[model samples]
Target: MQCPLPRIAVLWSALLFGLALSAGTTPALAQAERCPKLVAGNPFLQRLAPRTVPAAYVAPRQVGLTYIGHSTFLIETAGGVTVATDYNDYVRPAMVPRVATMNRAHSTHYSLNPDPGIEHVLKGWREDRDPVHYDLDIDDLWVGNLQTNIRDWRGDTIRNGNSIFVFRAADLCIAHLGHLHHTLTHDDIGALGRLDVVLAPVDGSYTLDIDGMIEVLKSLEAPVVIPMHYFNESTLENFLTRFAGRDYAIERRESPELVLSRETLPRKPTVIVLPPGG
Candidate 1:
């Protein structure tokens, strides 16, 4: 997976600059304490084993994920905390989410009138204000973000205009690539910590190119990668074709939902293709 060095260099540079100007979401240096990181380095990186080895045995600590079409997903945590990603007027979860995360790349990615019942509305970008950062540790879940830049409608760079939202729960971390526009930098990877699962935009046009998106996914080294923000089936298939017999196994599921747990992730790095509209 070779990319043009010059293009990558530019993308990396812009992100570094964005981080410098952005304020207080993640510490500058990755904590000496890494998040259950490094599949090879830390024994804790391995998923917590289930109580029994029975075929039907389920993990005690688990998260339920349902794809709600486009980039929106309904994430239900064990403690009854519901989270909606890329919450917008066009597509939303059935019920109001306790927490909502939105990106401003397009009207479809955000809403002007989000539900007032939402306990926490995490806006990924702000206009004429410093980028927003969050470190919310609540019942059964922890949410944080690393800031990144995005391209506006006219193709102008908006500094600190996007965020990579990370949700930590039940000894696993999941990241959503909110309208991500560039390949990640070394510092970006370090700050993001270990990612067991990633929700990525694979449109290869509106977001980062397919190559760069794949590059970002590989750099994070998450065992589970799920595709989102694709408009049509062909677009989704094109992204899957690139990985067909390569680094990741492709699983096409009939259901557009998943139950993720440290004990239940596939042993191999896999691209789980959940159909849209759950």
Candidate 2:
């Protein structure tokens, strides 16, 4: 004996037919067109660059980071790539970084001999040498650096090389603005493309002042900004006060390290505070 068609199936088929007639498109055609493109050579695929990680790339279960007091930060990327900015003594003893950057402005900025485990050590300045632009590409880490300068303690303008390190991983571009004492030129802006997150020095003493820093942020317009170099709460408060009218949200994360992707970023500007021990 032939079985009868289910009542619910018949009703659903009729509803779908009616919707298709109203929309002027077949369900199969619409579904086929809506499917995401995965080819690497397509122009549309560039947008996916921030989301695609190579199969060889190993995602870390926990992204390790330690806020080595002052302007130093140690970031271990998902692929076991270690990056240390302004390598100093304040870093946690547990983190044995593979790569480190040193700026020659102050004692806190540079350490002559770091751990023996560190394979790649990049110095911002070279003796009697012209400015160098370095591009480092390991298995899963991409770092680019540009040299800049800041003033010294003697009230005299000094030419010290600073590295603006950019790390690209897990479909996000993170930049560390090291002791940026001057405004970014148009060329500088062009070189540094869309930034998902930015680590900036807000102390206003060594780096750019409050107003200058604000201008830099406005020009860059990164989605997330993490302020560093401030000594006390009052300094941070002063920096936060400037964004009263702005729609920037301040979020205090339990840890200094944040994992993110293209789909998880905020629409408006956000300030993330990473307190000590975080």
Q: Please, what is the whole-model Cα lDDT of each candidate in the order they appear?
A: 0.76, 0.63
Candidate 1, residues 1-278, lDDT tens digits: the string is: 22244665554455446446444333322321133432223334223322222112223477788899899998877667778999999999888988999998988889999999999999987786365767676555668787778888899888767878888766778889989998887767756767889999999999999999888988988999999999998999889887677679888889987889888898899999898786
Off by over 4 Å in 1: 1-59
Native-referenced Cα lDDT, model 1 = 0.76
Worst 10 residues of 1 by lDDT: 49-58
Query: Judged by lDDT against the true structure, how good is candidate 2?
Result: 0.63
- Cα-based RMSD of candidate 1: 8.3
lDDT of 2 by residue, 1-278 (tens): 11133543553354335434431112211111111111112344334333323223235332344566677877766666777888866554356677888777777777877877888888766655345455666555556664556666776654435667776654466778877887765445444556777888898767789988988888888988888888899998888888545678888777655566656689878988887553
Residue 232 alpha-carbon offset, candidate 1, angstroms: 0.6
